[model samples]
Target: MNSESSAQIDVTKPHPARRYDYWLGGSVNYEADRASADAVAEAFPTIHLAALENRSFLRRVVTYLAAEAGISQFLDIGAGLPTAGNVHEIAQDITPAARIVYVDNDPIVLAHARTLLDSSAQGATAYLDADVRDPERILTHPNLLATLDLSKPVALMLVAIVHFLTDDDHPHDLVRRLCDALPPGSYLVMSHGTDDYLDIEDRAETSAANQRSGVPFQLRSTAEFSRFFTGFDLVAPGITSVTTWRPEGWRPHPRKEAVSMLGGVGRIGTRAVG
Candidate 1:
């Protein structure tokens, strides 16, 4: 869609994209988003930490993909509002010609695409109003394929978004279908929410609150998160806390909260699933 058309996107419902933007301290969120986020936050106090760790994971994994894995094209599925150090920015910094396609069903994301998420002239960026479950639509979307070459190795990032898919959404099968379409040497980067560290009552309360918001939030176990990366070679460190995966030198702040999120990056190859 053109810039003018994209501006007509809905601003009413509490979109997950905008709620996430608010969590990241961005200004693109609406009141409804703030309300929804406030409710979720009140129930799950660690959400803020999860958001930070999740974003950090995105940055670290993208850097690894571009610098070490030598990938130039990125397909960021369910990509929320473009924030600091987005996929293209990180990748293009390492390889100037890196191409990226940011996919989301939220219209608000598209409205801000050309401005908030501009790409370097040497590289390319595009947005699509597509759902995560619709792999074929996303893969075949003209705008997506225009910027990304499916034939070549690409990093398919689904960080912090799969949990938005409830059981009926069949998130596991959806991920597998998307991976099956990619060529060997491609990669899948995922970070999912979990309740492993929470008490039973807290977990139940948090789950119920998320359900009330019209968006079903599914928190999986470490093993469950790993299942999404099946049929691929897990990168060094495998699935672990975001801080533990390729941790930088700076010591992390003392934990005021507990962490229940699990994340990791995996590589695809011609051999059997890793």
Candidate 2:
């Protein structure tokens, strides 16, 4: 756990993080990742739109958190392979001293995290080879300790990650534990997949296809996803489609239900859990 050699990359088995990188058009993916993604696309044709929309929402949320909400620190759990407009870039672009820590368990992502460490002189950046399931490990990691101030308001970003936590994992409790560590006035910028738009038949096919590929994914309902924000208050455009959340004039692209997801930025209260 202390060394990079601890977590070895398995090129033969596809990882969700790598598959996501592939969807975002980053070259840091393998044939297994591409094949896994292609299978998902075959089940859900407009999967590309989902990837783009999630990234777009991340842009708006980060901008709002740094520029408007005045959050100076960000803890992005399940941080996938870095691409355009990463959390540190967006936050530091607005406030040069903003600090960011990227948490991920993917060996490929952990290996490539050096690219994510190029921070502005005024800001700080670090990466942790930690799993989201182990909230305490991530919260107390030396990298996080060096990069972030836990007493200050920090944005806990779980964008496009919870769906990978199967029902048996108690992902909502996992979310609560992560959020509980942040101070008051902090925010949870979260997004999740749901079968809200997909028909029951398509949903079944999607789940079956991913199971065949050994992907641990579970699609929840809007109410189920909303429970992750139990102790907080949602920003305007509460829990709507990714493109519909406080959308800029350019959002809600022609792809309608293809990018279907419920996303929001919720402000935490004084207590740990509400």
Best by TM-score: 2
lDDT of 2 by residue, 110-134 (tens): 8888778988999999888888999
TM-score of 2: 0.96
Cα lDDT of candidate 1 equals: 0.82
Q: On a 0 to 100 scale, what is the lDDT of residue 123 in model 1?
A: 88
Instruction: List the global CA lDDT of all models.
Output: 0.82, 0.86
Model 1 agreement with the true structure over 94-187: per-residue lDDT tens digits: 9999998888888878777775358887888888878998899888888876777888988889988998898889988899888888889999
Backbone clash count, each prediction separately: 1, 0
Give model 1's TM-score versus the native structure: 0.93
Error of 1 at 273 (Å): 4.6
Top of the candidates by lDDT: 2
Stretches off by above 4 angstroms in model 2 are 1-5, 272-274
TM per prediction: 0.93, 0.96
